[model samples]
Target: MAACGLDFGTSNTTLGRWQDGAPRLLRLEGGHVTIPSAIFFAPGREAVIGRAAMSAYVEGVPGRLMRSLKSVLGSSLLEETTPVGRERVRFRDVIGRYLAGVKARAEAEAGKSFDTVVHGRPVHFIDDDPEGDRKAEDALRGIAESIGFRHVSFQYEPIAAALDYEQGIAREELALIADIGGGTSDFSIVRLSPERHSRADRAGDILANDGVRIGGTDFDRMLSLGTVMPLLGLGSPMRRGDLAVPNAYFHDLATWSSINRLYNSKTLREIEETRRDASRPELLGRLHAVVEGERGHSLAMEVEGAKIATSERGGARLDLGWIEGGLAAEIDRDGLVRHTGDLARRIAERIGRCLGQAGVGADAIDALFLTGGSTGLPHVRAALTTCLPQARVAEGDTFGSVGTGLTLEAARRAA
Candidate 1:
């Protein structure tokens, strides 16, 4: 039985296979191992995935662009439909189609079909909602089986990352895996070594697992609201004097998962109404331009870029040319901290709880392994380090670790 590991992340996806006594990730898109978890339904054409989708949307192709598809899981919206082209498409089907594409590409790359797979999932799909979390997993499992996977199993994303890191270490160590992805931050404390690799059962090796719903997308939203949304009358006073411009519209625009909500006729009419009642009509007009132009995704992309850029430089420039010509915003590191500080603190507290659950002191941990795209942010690193100052920090393939680890697990299970 041939098996593979699939990391169906909110921001990106990767498929991996066990080969040559090691885990190997397949090239899913034009020799790229990672595919942007995005889809575009262009007019009169087939849906496209990854970079092609982003390009089509950015090129002004007439159709619907969907990103952050994973965020819909465990939410009521997962059962709903959205307008795409001339038809309404179910969100679950959208996810199924995307996963099917990944499966096809993986089979082509591996020269074989994979019936069994170990899929990576967050520790908690929905925070403080057990029913929703269960539904999310069930939904994912249903999607996987529907797409021809006969033997489907699950692995925590952070645990998968830990497994990948364990492969490179020669000695046993108490390791903490911090996986900060686009939609969640998950933590796992595990005992790992070369000796543990041969064991088929790792239930006893895992000490504790914890996670929070906060992630990169949340940071992007915070940054967007703090800097860009205000420019479009998010907090400006309405003509009624006592009331401020409605924030729901700006919040949806700032959030990748909710951006599509701003494209409807009702939302447009509401925006017009708000514009009429807005004391700063110019700002509301800018907001109208954004929603009317269907540029919410483009704007979110710009904000995401600025967030990533702020990690390296003192500040980053966001070009909002779609909103208005010569319109832009600058975001600094301090601003990033100000907007996301509470999130970082919460993440740090979660790490503390993980440690507490494992019955281990922070000093007892041997290493802190950081993976996932969001872990690259300096503020996130600082937050984690604050929790475990004595432990050495090691960075894994931010995007590939979980998939690679899943492949390793798949091979173990198949054997």
Candidate 2:
């Protein structure tokens, strides 16, 4: 039976197999190795995944767009039902169907069926909750097995990145691996060398592994809440009482996982009731329009795009005219720093805990290997590199490293 490695990440997914004596990622989406972790279901019809899903939603197709799928792993939302078009489906099945589609694409690309798989997982699915973490892993394992894998295993994401990094190293070195992705920021301190590359047992090489549930999506949420949500009457005062509008609806609307939760009739009625007392009914009306029209994901995509633009060019203009004519916002490097400073610090703090767990000083690390899409953020990268100034920075194939590394693990297990 064939084996492969699956990195079903929060923002993107990649599947890889050991081929021609090296780990190679399968082209799952039209010659692309990485596919956005998204799916769209249109009423009673079949579902489309990856970029097609995003495009269908953008093209005004009537469907439910589900993104940031990994965030539901440890949360109650995993088993909870959400409206997918005209039908209600559990998040678990939605995830399973997405994985199944990805597996089929990989098998078709490689011309081989895979039965055993190694999956990449964050060190902690939910921070500081051991039982929740275990439950999340168990749920993922069940999902993988349910999809068709006869045997399943998991490797910590950062460690998998480390393994991928180890392949090019010539001599022994203590390296720190930072995997800052869509849903979690995971870290690892590992000893890597050419000699260890062929070793089947790598338990002793991984000195420490730690993670926090903060990532690119969290950054996007913070940006949306701070900059975009207020325009939707998030903190506007009410006409009846001294209290401002309750923040729950806006919070859910800003968050990717919970956005769908606000589309129900109960939420619409509650929003209508809230609008009656709202001092600015026009803003509440916009909120009503967003939820009623299911435009939350579109707004989120705008925020994410702005975040990327701001990171790349130091400034970005958010055109929200589609929601309300002439409505817009601007975000720059300074605003990103102001809004996401706390999250960046928390990510840096994880690195400290990782070092302490390894019982090594920061200066002892020879290389700082960075992977995952979030690490491209300037401030987040600064926060980590500043903490380990002596270490040389090495960038991995941000979205592919973990899957490639996991394929190595799968190969080892098969052998």
> What would the TM-scores of all predictions be?
0.99, 0.99
Global lDDT of each candidate: 0.93, 0.94
Cα lDDT of model 1 by residue, 61-180, tens digit? 898899989999988889899998789888999999999999999999999999999999999999989898999999999999999999999999999999999989989999999999
Q: Please provide, for model 2 over 35-153, each residue's C-alpha lDDT reduced to its tens digit, 9 standing for 90 to 100.
A: 99999998767999999999999998998999999999999999999887667889999999999999999999999999999999999999999999999999999999999999999
Report residue 130 deviation for candidate 2 (angstroms).
Answer: 0.8
| Inter-residue clash pairs, candidate 1 | none
Q: Tell me the spans in candidate 1 whose CA falls farther than 4 Å from its real position.
A: none
Error of 2 at 182 (Å): 0.2
Best lDDT goes to which candidate? Answer: 2
Please count the clashing residue pairs in each candidate, in the order shown.
0, 0
Cα RMSD, each candidate: 0.9, 0.8
- lDDT at residue 100 of model 1 (Cα atoms): 94
Residue 273 of model 1 has an lDDT of 92
